[model samples]
Target: MIVHKKPEPTKVPGFWEIPSISFPIHIAKNFAKHVNILPDVEYWSPFLNSKTCNYLRDIFLESMILAPVSINGLMDQSYGIGSKRATGWSLQLSDMLSEFIIPHLNEKFCSAKTSTDWWQENPKKNQAWLPVQVSPLFRFMKYESGGEHYAHYDAGFMYEDGIHRTLKSFVIYLTTNQSGATRFIRNHLEDIDVWDRDHSDWNRRALKEEVLYSFLPQEGSILIFDHRICHDVDVYLGEENLPRIIIRGDIIYQAKSL
Candidate 1:
């Protein structure tokens, strides 16, 4: 009897293939000067210049069909409405790329004092925290004209030891659009009685009164927030010719003994 073995997965491309552009040091330094539009959320614009953004977008669009696309990491053809509305393409970033971008994100946004304070105040304070790393696995998502994600919270990825996990989530907008704002809610998922009862029964647009903030899509802008925040995407009202495009990933920190 002859048996067939499963095929090995194809290796993803490395980061060096991505075009390297100079970091916008001046813009990043003034990130704090922006008006406090949302609580516990940091927003920075033009993180990548127009040329870089366009190049990245073109690369993704060109290779989207060849890349591994999934819904919440599952290759299942049928997905429930509650999981996500946008189409996600998973891309693996090389260690070299993670090292390249993490320092910019850390020095410009997460200072040593801030990291130390967060570690000390965390409930899992017993474990020593290592420097944060940009997650190797990230999704480049595209939303169509009618696409809309239901209210949901993000889960952290356990990268190293059980104690080391993703503490923050970030979105980098690759394309600008007239609609499809990411809306954050003031209430927690547990606080919403209907959310627990049935996801299909939940109305995505009914939470306007509870909205804490709404971030419109802007090219080359980055938005970082706590992983536990409950948020949803507004219905994409852009023209059929344009789809909302963004990169979503987590910031992971390793834990070690002192």
Candidate 2:
């Protein structure tokens, strides 16, 4: 007698709730757009103006022409990177960050005071209060036709100077595209039992089986989420040569113990 096997469980509708907020003001004009994001994800709309976006996109395109594109993700090239023929290029924007991004982040965004004032005004007698930090690491990502990413979490921030660094992942769309939205899982994949297997294998399976919350990639718009969240870029559904381009960075938080 043959025994009937139990069918695999299907993902439930609205199993994970994705919440978003609008930052029409307060954040810079470039990061002032209506955001579609996962719950707890921080959004700074209008992260870049049209002019800046165009300038950055041109830089990425020129780099692709000058340098050979490298495969992204794990060295194994699995989890949709190799299969979809996706490629990436990286740029170190420390100079840009110091000249432009850092000033804005400290003055207008995270903390509105200069380092001297921030330290002097703090309650700590030793002036040891930790301050906000931004990672110099940045990447310019590109995905052509059928290019995509499987579900995965970003790298965590490294500890620095006896301070625990908690990272917030940032991505800004630089290309005009309506189809290549980023998909984020509602909950952390590490907490789920289904993803207990090998990283590559489980990530690909989670892409198909997990509940996904998606955000449309708007030009100049930025999405920042806690690094532990699982996310991936959806397959490009538009024209072949028209690639989806984005700039990625990380924000590290340093907080004093209460």
Candidate 3:
């Protein structure tokens, strides 16, 4: 005897399954051109629309829990001086962001001499290096009035495969501020004195003349730079009621195999 079988249920995608937003071609070209000229830094204004920025800000403020800054598993105040919250691992968010930016980054870097010479280190003779993804977790940071981050370098995180690591760091500004600009130092890594628990004299070491670049926060804008760059945040001097809000993430790259 033959038995009738029921058809399987169709699966529905989650809320975060919305289509990835594509950056404008002209904006992408501009970003590439500026980065190519600057070599290690680029600030893309209005990368995300005001509505999207508002949505992210609302969600983060409502759902995420902020805590004192933690450094290397400890709540340290010497290095970073602000509150931070992590969105945890979200593959959807990571893929969305990566899809929006990776294509442009890959196209620009893979074809440009600036990337081969300055961005990447010891790349394989002829192998191709590509940006794979943005980090799965996004760190939301809040710097209240009088808060500041000392001079420091962002350390890259290695992927499970060991061949890839976070090559670039990015920050998305959610709120506009008159102060609290991100300052990049011109000194070499060896010459810069990074802030530590015992040594908190980064202010004295980071001279005004050594500042290579300073970017003020703009709502819906993003700043991207090499992970090796020495940078710090100037003291937050904005309104006491409005703190500086930013989302931080990294771009992982598949380096040419050694």
Candidate 4:
């Protein structure tokens, strides 16, 4: 007898979804096995398994306990972004990227061809061709009561060596909290087109735009979106003793040559 599986739902051009897969059990299987660039953002859940999430959370907690509070970081008070007293530990180029992120991007998002074409069409002097890569910076953020992140955009950066565009932002929840959800602002097609331009101040514009969606904290679930999107964290309303914990990182891509 012949049987047929149900057809998947039609995905919006700028949106993609990968359903939940229990951690450590199906973690080896591709969570984003079937994914593509959506109209505005990409949302994938169950990216990290329970064991992996707990392991990283413990490491971050231990690091926070050992490190001294430093006042220097990315969040800008002038723009009203990030937690007022945010504290955490960080690691650049974690091994988890190769184990989890790269595979998903290549197999699911089909970024390989896209990166190659981008570099070929926009070649620069003294630069060498490179594959689409993800450089993950592991960050642990804890927000106390009343902490909030104002509307903002993740800006692209340039360096003496090369430029690094934050193509995607990844957030992994470490703690469950009712408040302090991350919110993103919706944009008109024209607004998105403007943001697509180089050095556009979309984050600043997000302050006055309508909200697209708000993501609540769910342990082990991963939220991914285009860095160009305008987003912020809501004020934490729970008890002072209860802090929201989150793992943050950026999927960086840029053409670099020797």
Q: Write the per-residue lDDT of candidate 4 for residues 1-258, one digit (tens) a residue.
A: 111122232421111122222333225234543234343355566566667767666655554432211212244455443442222312223333534664454221313212111222233532332224444334467776766665655643332344433455677787778988888765443333332434223443335347667778876666766555657777678654777878666665555443
Give the lDDT of residue 214 in candidate 1.
84
Q: Lowest summed lDDT over 10 consecutive residues: which window, candidate 1?
A: 1-10
Residue-by-residue lDDT tens digits, candidate 2, 1-258: 111122222322111111121111123453453434444465665666777677667655654421223234543543334222112212224334324344444211223211111222234423223325445445567677766665666655444243434346778787778777777754433443322422332244234455566777777777766565667776677664777878776665444452
Count of clashes, each model: 0, 7, 0, 11
lDDT for model 4: 0.49
Superposition error at 75 for model 2 (Å): 3.3
- The residue-by-residue lDDT of candidate 3 on 97-143, one tens digit each, is 77677876752243332222223343353245567787765677777
The ten-residue window of minimal lDDT in model 3 covers: 9-18
Q: Tell me, by TM-score, which candidate is best.
A: 3
Ranking by lDDT: 3, 1, 2, 4
Candidate whose lDDT is highest? 3
> What are the models' TM-scores?
0.65, 0.61, 0.71, 0.60
* Alpha-carbon deviation at 27 in model 2, angstroms: 8.5
| Each model's lDDT | 0.55, 0.50, 0.61, 0.49
lDDT score of residue 224 within candidate 4: 67
72 Cα displacement, candidate 4 (Å): 14
